[model samples]
Target: MPTPSEFFDPSFIAILKLFLAMLLGGIIGTERAVFARQAAGTRTFGLVAMGACLFIVTGNYVDVAYLGVLSFDPLRVAAAIIMGIGFLGGGLIIFRGDSLHGVTTAAGLWIVAGIGMAVGFGLYLIAIFATFLTLLMFTGMWFVEDRFKHWFEEVKGDSR
Candidate 1:
């Protein structure tokens, strides 16, 4: 039998994964948190990602401990997490008369959950790439959107 330290050392991978999830979530949330329109902030995003990772890690632990004798599915836990995150995302959206706001924030919540899952599954590269792309979308796309809005308004004014 191995010592306690040796037995517990293997679990460090899960901790690393969860930390990555938290870091990615914090990056995304930082961008949103700076804006006044966002409903979810850094802490919320961090928690969501970390929470998702925790569930996946826990399910995996149970599955491994039981081996083939018991059927503990990590995918089921993932599915449930997705569903719950969806509900939470819905809460971020606000529908107004002519426009809908908070859609981006809601989408962020959903994608952050996905990032967490990827990390939990040991897909570090995938999670990092997704985080980079998400940040680009959130930041770069804002400028593009603003420019297009300005151009559209100018065109509309000239037409009138």
Candidate 2:
């Protein structure tokens, strides 16, 4: 059977990828906002993901279109993106007296950026799976950490 016309159109595929990246980022960001109460929320994350997707998709297009005029390395852009996100994440983190805050939020931003790149590179399944894993870590691990802390306190009390 012949494939649908939309499947062959690069524009359509790019739009779809951008949309999916935004959706995935929004999901992760919502969890962070509502549960973790992080500063970066749904709209911020959605914009980040879509921005990464656009960068990668545009880089790929340029590389393909100008195959001989100049050399274009998509990895270069990806690396820059990682570095840029690191700066943004660093800004989100704050060190106070004997405590640090926004570390998880910073890390989540970095990972969500990677997820956006994956969507841009046509790895939909991997991106989706990673999104779910991120949510599981953010939500499920909180409960686990609390229980472990409680158990440790109980054991310490008994020993004393």
Task: Write candidate 2's Cα lDDT for 64-110 as tens digits.
Answer: 89999998899999999999999998999999999999999889889
Candidate 1's displacement at residue 60, Å, is 1.2
Instruction: Please give, for residues 8-91, the per-residue lDDT of candidate 1 as tens digits.
Output: 664887888789999999889988998644769898998898888888888888898899899787889999999999999989
Score candidate 1 by lDDT. 0.88
Per-residue lDDT for 102 in model 2? 92
Q: Candidate 2, 129: how far from true, in Å?
A: 0.4
Question: Candidate 2 — number of clashing residue pairs?
Answer: 0
Per-model TM-score, in order, reads 0.88, 0.93
Model 2 earns a TM-score of 0.93
